[model samples]
Target: MVDLQEQAWAALLYVVLMLVQQWIHWIPGDLG
Candidate 1:
């Protein structure tokens, strides 16, 4: 049970980090 929750949280964190990375790459393009 707890293990499942931990995996879910890890997946969520990974997705959020990916989105943040996308934004970081995207913003430079918009400004430049």
Candidate 2:
């Protein structure tokens, strides 16, 4: 259903944000 799709999208967004944060942390002096 639409609800499931929405949930999946939200989860994906969360994962992407986490990855970006991790990448920023890996780089020195990024200060993200």
Candidate 3:
């Protein structure tokens, strides 16, 4: 059960990180 919970949390963190990266990429002047 603990392992499953950890996996879920890791997946969620990965998704959130990806979203943040995309968001930054979308904003103008963010490339610098």
Per-residue lDDT of model 3, residues 1-32, tens digit only: 59999999999999999999998888899566
The top-ranked prediction according to lDDT is 3
Clashing pairs in 1: none
Worst 10 residues of 3 by lDDT: 23-32
Instruction: Flag regions of model 1 displaced more than 4 Å.
Output: 29-32
Clash number by candidate, in order:
0, 0, 0
TM-score of each prediction: 0.77, 0.78, 0.82
Local distance difference test, each candidate: 0.91, 0.91, 0.93
Q: What is the lDDT of candidate 2?
A: 0.91
What local lDDT score does residue 10 receive in model 1, on the 0 to 100 scale? 100
Candidate 2 Cα outliers beyond 4 Å, as residue runs: 30-32
Query: Residue 16 in candidate 2 has what lDDT?
Result: 100
Please give the range of 10 consecutive residues that has the lowest summed lDDT in model 2: 23-32
